[model samples]
Target chain A: MAVRADDIPVPRGRPRLAGRVREWLDQESILGPVFVTPALLLLVLLVAYPFLMALYFAMSNAFIGRPSEFIGIRNFVRLWDSDAFRQTFQNAFVFTGIAVAFKLVFGICLALLLNEQLWFKRFIRGAVLLPWVIPTALSTLGWWWMFNSLYSVVNWTGIAVGFMDPPGPNWLGQKYYAMTAVVTVNVWRGLPFFAITILAGLVAIPRELYEAAEADGAGPVARFWLITLPLLKPVLAIVVLFSTIFTFSDFNIVYVLTRGGPINSTHLFATLSRVVGIDTGRIGEGAAISLYLFPLLVFVVWAQLRFVRKQAY
Target chain B: MEPIRRRRFLTTAAGGLAGILATRVPPARGQQREVSYLCWNNFAPASDKKLAEIGQRFTRDTGIKLKIDHVSHMGPQQAKYASEVQTQAGHDLVEMRMHFPWLYEPQLVDVSDVVGELEKKYGKAISSAYEGAHVNGVWRAVPQYHGMFVATYREDLFKKASLKVPDTWEDLYTVGKELKKMGNPVGIPISQNYDSISTAGPVLWSFGGMEVDKDGKTVRINSPATAQTIEWYKKMFRDCMEPEVLSWSDASNNESIQQGKAGWIHNPVSAYIVAKQRKLVTADGINHHRSLGGPQGRHETDTPRHIGIWKFSKNVEPAKEWIRYLLGKREVYDEYIMSGDAFNLPVYDKLQDHPVLRTDPKYAALRGEGVQYHTYGWPAPPSDKVQLITNTYLLPNMLAKAVTGTSTKDAIAWAEIEMRKILAG
Candidate 1:
């Protein structure tokens, strides 16, 4: 016989279960987590898992294809004593510090110039981005050709302009010169990001504030110092932080240009990691070398975030 | 009723997940024969074309499929091999170069059967071939070919300087100095490049210096002979070579000679071949000769190539068959050499007199140079430790440190320390 829904003896937990599920489905908080579950899972698998694996590998005596043993901090300790690793660590700091500083200065100058009412402004902005827009490996190859000792166009230009004596400078042959050449290329490639980003920040600044600063009898320099600089601090901090990270772990420019050469003068953390980890098949040491900069990068990023948060508050 | 529905839903979802995972799992193979080979980019495109043609022919003959992957021969290729060995996955067959057979010996399959069969047909292989492919009394790989380093120089420059072609290291230095005075410097890469390692090998050996002993257990880089080699390089860097040699890549020496700025280079015949092919410089403008003799003896560096099947490969038999087929037939091997423009030298004694070498005047000297060819860590059996040192470029870096102003004693001392650390590890 057919039975009514209420006529059937209600299961002991049926009503409670229905109520709980309905409440969970109806609540926005529950829905929020449910909707984000896929993304969270992806984040764990893609980003967090590899990062954790790298951490594990760094602590183990792992060679590619060979079984690994837990070696504690031996990899880190060895890298600490390694002359090559020490030099690479030092190179990372110097290369990033100089590259970021120049990128900022040039970026701001170019942004200011581009902001002015001028002919071909759009064209100039787009053209300025070619170095950034091109694939880094391909662009660096072009730079390599230009830095060639015998067939370098830069040397050719210098010779024709009489700015250099015969034979010209070997742009990538000496320690100091190679460092300078890599830094210059880094700056050249990174400038567009800063320019476009800072330009956006510049455009976002309300015109009324600048007008008021000028009305208060401020000169161009005074208005810039009082209004433009303060207004651009947050954006500048962000751009600089990104550029710093990119420069610190940079592999393509150094690898393509010198392969950290002329005697390991230009090796960065990434190239050194490859040399140790992949090339030498010392995955453990390579992993340790790569992660050595993690703590410093965390500090830099955290400080920038805190500064941004303080400004926001 | 509600609990039952929820349980049903959970079960359905779990089953769906299981189904997805099952689909992702590779299906079991019955008897389909297929293998993939990974190798470095050939010096000439025609060489790759020849290889592909042979692969297709193999497929036709045996009903087995062959796939070949060619990658750049430098850093990336090394990384690929390391990755494959570490992961225990990738390519059924791989081209092993230099010290790789020894470096990854545990992961490679024994190819004694292939090598033995081929040797029975083609006489004895060269000693250098055995030096690279045979490790621990096991044939780890099949010796493929040798890329010999010979001197490529400008005949025009030598004529203008009224100097004969250098037959010894001293003569090279003397000629190099004269060329430099004329603003045409000899370009021997003093930097950390593959060519630098090859160029340094002969010099170090010629001076009777070695990085390791014949047992591959002792560090011998701190000898007086090594110190003398360092001093000689310092003088060469100061007087004969351009400062730019410190930063030269593997391609720089080729470019320097092609552009008419370099008077001499120690490279494979690729430079000369390219110059003639491109007409960047005419054939008459360029000339090639055997490596210069050092005080100890006349020797050259050999970057031998080998073929090995991975232990983890599913189609090991097919991989072995492919290697045997490629290396066994003299006609096919000679064709490969011809296609490569004589860039690849035969490892078998019988094929040494192949028409490819005998026909070309430029390749004549190289034909017999293999007898005098030596690999790095020479006299010493190549080991993983030795491979690590080679890859890290410790030897070249030592010379660079010395030539760039670090004292010879200090440079050798540093190298000894580095070598010890590598060996100990």
Candidate 2:
């Protein structure tokens, strides 16, 4: 037998295993797949699988722990007849619309304010994120106490300041007030995300643009309207898109605060889905309720991304 | 030594893997036997502690290691059950409340044998327990204990105002008015919560209202009886309770009475038990009254809890052993019940007069004399449809709508349509 390198026996240990792994990874195709396999597995297990399961469940009469039959679009169609579902559908739009609008406006103002050379800028910036950083469920519990009918600090303060009647508004009890309270908490918790992200966008705006505008005799308002607003469009569009989806799907604030209560006025699709699916064991209906907005949301994402691309390029 | 080729190595590895797969057992089969039980954090905290202590004793005596986990009673517990059932995995045993056995019938192990042994040793399980766990003529769970809703009121406040304890739902309105005027409103939650349904169920049943007929198909929410229930709630909402009742959770009523804010609340004895346990200032002042009656009959909401073994559990025998150890033994069962401070009462007919009731004179109302206790959606079996009606909160929402300005007729119509839709679906 001619001496062959292949006939040589290497050490039977980690080095051999490591050598095999290194050899496999050295190939471009193998390396690409090896790197992607984990993320692909994760997406399949965590996201894609659940999403497809939800889609199937939405089309079937899937009760928890029970045999189910395919019911086609009946679940989706039947959901329309429910007053609660109707209210939830309307509430999702209202909640997302109002919350995103407020977050955008307030986020911009706060970002501008933070962009200034204020004292303790770093501390102020960090403090602004407190609402967003704290666990939503835990923080919402605090807001629940403040909005509690029996012991409302907001009511107490309002009374102390002689700003309202003796008894303050039933923040989480009545329909309109409960919606306002939930929207208010959503805005509070979400403002920091908008502020920080917009601030990054604000910072990325070259100082030269403002200086040139100023030199052109443009007032501060004019400069902002002409330069800053146009430049921030992409960031704002992306932010608004994410915020809209998030607000529509918000669960904790409504669940911990009002539980979509006072006649389901504050119910978002997420809470309604929970009530229908897990609480009631109508997993099919719950899935339908949650996925009801999927088409609309997809449109929103596509439209906003298109807007962003337009601005970016 | 011969050098191993990749093909030979893969062949041997594949053979070993196939052997393991065919056997359907882990390669390391020397692990100790263990059983895990998932229960809710009992309203009486001491009961949870007692459960853990008993679990340790179970391990020591049976040599089967036991693990216990508790989630919150209502929403979280239900969510946990759904997740477990959907995944076909989790703890081997679960504590089921009310109609959960019906909802999770397919997933639960048939424990008729265990329940039969328990019934022979103790007595027949209470009607509520039977209704809850006896699914489709099979015992899906072993009846553990029950906590019936009672009228928890401030005795001191009633004495101060010289107000008569409410005997009926109508009488409650009268006293409720005085209670509100005294700045301590009656706290019967009418929101999207089980407590809301708990109170609403009794009130509706008393007024001869049934959400669904006994057949469990007809939507009877539009009946005159239901309208009467809604009207009563509207006035009660206007004159007696605060707008806060419209936003209360299961714990809100408990907290209201415990904190001396509400003069009265409809809840289990857990409210007073917690107050007494915590030595709150209002503990001594709080007392229980029998559940109020309605025009149809005296009906109350009973929350019966049971222990169930999952069908998917490999350690079924060990799981059953834990239940037998916890509830099968008389002394152990009594000790466990006593630890609840009357919040968790024995569900057996023989133990109805459990000494835990005598633990405090305040618990006397838990006796629920002559008050027919049923779970939510009574008159109709706790089928999945009835449960859907209950969970959808049609009852509370109807009352909420009526109280919030929607016409009683309109609200009742809305609820009827919703109920019929669910039943038809």
Candidate 3:
């Protein structure tokens, strides 16, 4: 029963225009592209355009409000000579390394604790996400107030409790202490994200493995070490990957807390880029600073995703 | 005169619209005739409110509609201007701070005529304003107002201690030691902020050290004068100030004095103005003295704000009208200046003795009779490179390093290298 299009009966009150549209939409190739066109357009306009522009700016001698020319990799090469840029490069690693490590350890413990049968589990789980739920800049301002040199409530409380000497440590005034303050705030803000994602991974782990381990006369520690740890590898990998990128590019905490101060000790790539590019009107150098880590980040993403796929298969 | 018909009306309307679009010109009925201005959120909140009110009145008096927008004074304001310039769009006018006119000279419309007229009426613009808005022998922007750094101190404490008002930076150091012993340390910030640069510039200039030579190319931070300036700061940080100044924001010094912690601070009169407005206990105790002098001469940092019209703006004429209305009219300008509570002052020679100064006794320090006020880069022309040095916090960082235990010579060497790199680039 091969039917021609002309031989098919048209429905009553269906206009020819509507019928033609319906026929076009019924085809997979037409409908697929039609549905995806808006999203593809948005991605091109929003993400790809800016990224390509930044790429161009990074390689060119672009100053704000002035005509620029493409100058090869000179901007990228020149940034290496700057002490601030070098300091920023080192700071980015130290900040991300310490902040992410703390988040991972704390996240696992929190997720493990959350997995147990506890009272008011739903309420407790919701409450744990408060740091991540609030806006980063707004929440960081609260942290700034706590760490302020003049009106630091942290020092006041510590002195009141006899836990610290009067006036306490200059958290934001000293380079090391400023770095510590920024990292502590970063970990506090990012922990909820890691914990919640790890919790989801924890929920998906089958109970049968633990039961089998227990039947084999395995202890609680042995069961967790052999079963729970191995199963959470892929999820942990994904969480760490995201956290590393986010932490490396972090701007708000350090900006509000130190403004990359105490001698550029806490400047991440993003804040340094803003200083060189926007504040100083050297958009070329600024873009270069921002994109300096792009290739490395891309490699990290690729390697992590490949590892994730290997685990999946 | 023919009677209108439906077909004729449609044809006429379509043709007119096509003509207007092709020519990129609107018909009389289609033109909105509006201009927008972008400025910073003033330290005095009332000034921002007064600006809005004046904008409304300007709209009512003139046919042109005016819109005013304010941004946070520090990072966000510069970012906003950069974005606008990059996009070739945004507000028609921007309130530029200090050497911003030089930074965006190409994009700013030449408003020499407006500036010339105002100059004739109000004597010449002050030296700092002239340095700021006058770029490459042309008026790139109209000088609006200036806020100068003055020595804000506790008068009551001085009276109680029977101390002489310090006339020189060295004298202040002598008095500052006693003030610290009395539990109120000097609150000069050595941080990465404009205020840090503000105090550092005057201190450096008064000691006759400049970041760059007047040629705007030679790195001059490595000088005997700079060493003396650093030595002054090192001693000040060690004895007269606390470690907290290293972390202070622009507002922190103001808060330190207003909260009765800081005995003296190099700042504008905003601190006392804010305290008086809030009826703080320290308001009565606070008074300002003329900016302190050094062995060379008296000097201070002047923050002159200007209005610049973007080259891309279609409403240039309307924008100029707004500027003339706000700044050219003496009474309107005075009303606006009065709202700033002496934090904002006239930047013209004739209007230097503004009535706002007479309103408060604490504002007398702002007169700065013998002090030579300069923007961030004093001897050096405020070119983009000099601005870069200021924006990079090289001066403050250099002082910071010195005060924090890096030898003054090493700090000066570091700053000289950094400045030379910027200048060469």
> Pick by TM-score: which candidate is best?
3
Which segments of model 1 are wrong by more than 4 Å?
A: A1-26, B1-31, B369-371
Fraction of true contacts retained by every candidate, in order, equals 0.61, 0.88, 0.71
Worst 10 residues of 1 chain B by lDDT: B23-32
List model 1 lDDT by residue over B86-179, tens digit each: 6778999999787678767788899998889888887777778888889899999999988888888888878977988988888888888899
Question: lDDT, candidate 2, residue A257?
Answer: 95
Docking class of 2: medium
- Compute the lDDT of residue A230 as modeled in candidate 1: 89
* Model 3: residues with Cα > 4 Å off, grouped in runs: A1-26, B1-9, B18-25
Residue-wise C-alpha lDDT for candidate 1, range A1-313, written one tens digit per residue: 9988899886688889998999998999898999999999999999999999999999998877678899988888878666677889899999999999999999999898888898999999899899999999999999998988867899899999999887788888889999999999999899999999999999899999988888889998998888889889999999999998899989999999999987788989899899878876778888999998898999999999899878767
Q: Give the TM-score of candidate 1.
A: 0.91
Quote the chain B TM-score of every prediction. 0.90, 0.92, 0.96
Q: Per-residue alpha-carbon lDDT of model 3 for B337-387, expressed as tens digits?
A: 999999899988899999999998778888889999899888888987888
lDDT minimum window of 10 residues, candidate 2 chain A: A164-173
**lDDT score for candidate 3 against the true structure:** 0.92
Clashes of 3: 0
